[model samples]
Target: MENPITRPRSVERLVAGQATSDGAGVKLTRVLTQDLQRRLDPFLMLDAFRNENPEDYIGGFPNHPHRGFETVTYMIAGRMRHRDSAGNEGLLGPGGAQWMTAGSGLIHSELPEQEEGLMEGFQLWLNLPAKAKMCAPGYRDIPPPAIPEYVDGAGVRVRVIAGDSGGVAGAVRRPDTEPLFLDLHLPAGAGFGQALPAGHNAFLYVYRGSVIVRGAPVADRHMAILGNDGDGVVLQADGDSRVLLVAGRPLQEPIVQYGPFVMNTAEQIHQAVRDYQAGKFAAAAVQAF
Candidate 1:
């Protein structure tokens, strides 16, 4: 049994979320640094968009380019239409996901086609290593049931998307992404302790309600960063709170980010655009949708 971690002595940065839109009218919530320059090393950003009115999110993300990173989309409440320049197209309904590794390069678009006039989901960005920066692009569209779910004796529910924690291997893959993904739910006024891997950079994003992390008290949409010293994290609920805990080892690499591309060097960004403009991997577009 993991012992309860005391109050975090080191303070965590309470980053504020921002609001933006892509694909014309698709609303989004940015959970990390407002400027891409300040984005975390291994993780770039997390965007959450939940809309019930079709007019709010139906426009979706238009044709765009990405390289040297992976785009993960998880739909919770509604449906989304996915078409990529790589010629992979599908309808990701509720509890479905589209994990795309835009290794070398890829062009894609996401359109929301909610059946009940609602569109809700998230898109997370993960950095890649220099060696795999130019690898071929690929994708995995996993449905709701494909993800692992675990229920604790204390009425805590967790959906594992990646990595292992709480006896759940969310999504199994060879040398899985270092990060652990969990959709956590805690009953009102309940408290729980999460044993974390030492030295792993981690954070919690509140989606539906407020939570008291280390007694700081965070509300929905706010991201709470955790220190690397502790082995487990403590979370206490103010109400029936729902949150997403994403933890991973820091890449500690130089990040050069542009609008849709994340590379290591500025020159790499320049070359990435040049390669795309020159049709270096133009055929990648054919398979994305």
Candidate 2:
């Protein structure tokens, strides 16, 4: 029998992350910024925040406002409490995730639940097209148990957060974006391959050990932007490796972003600022996803 998997997507380029601070005063590694390299359509930013020192993340994220995009926060360790102006509150512990869509606008805060230990997580920003930018503001708070996991015979485990993997689909329900966010752990010498939407843009971020992505080596804290020509990605573990794979459809529309706002034009950005200043985020008004 012959294998049907598509040719593995190769790495087009490697992006080195930088140290940065965000969310009140949280220290983090800015892995993929919107301005770096060519624009990664539909994805605005990717930040990895991991620290053993409480001082590094103790400040947490104070109340803040966002509009025109979605923020996905996945916690691998520690606990975070999220509260929004709509009176909705939730606690995200290890293996938990939160997908908050700030359509027109919203105000929220994420604070640490404990004093110390190993605090680690990733916050991803996904862009919305012009039609859905101001539709409604809503959120999906997913516990660890809600996320789907797939394990292969070779000891490779995949946590599917927003897309299908190994025939198992994630519980995250974002109709407009329909993105794929996965965390993969492969044992030493194990290999993994999965098909992806051909039209979607994809990238891989390695945060542990080393892995061979489409025949190219990717070490810790490095990001590999995959070529768009392939329909799937193949990776092999040089050692015990952990990585995050993210992909989403490109809107192919003009994107103008400022601070927490993302829009199609400069005028829309100014309007968003004025809307925030007028205290429009006081109400939850988050629309159903």
- Top TM-score model: 2
Highest lDDT, which number? Answer: 2
Give the clash total for candidate 1. Answer: 16
TM-score of each: 0.90, 0.96
Per-residue alpha-carbon lDDT of model 1 for 51-168, expressed as tens digits? 8777778677888888988888888787777777777888898877778889889888886665456677788888887877887788888888888887776677778888776666
In model 2, where is the ten-residue run with the lowest total lDDT?
Answer: 1-10
lDDT of 2 by residue, 57-156 (tens): 9889999998988999999899999999877789999999999988889999999998979999999999888998997788888999889997888889
In angstroms, the error of model 1 at 97 is 1.7
Model 2 accuracy (lDDT, Cα): 0.86
Residue 275 alpha-carbon offset, candidate 1, angstroms: 1.4
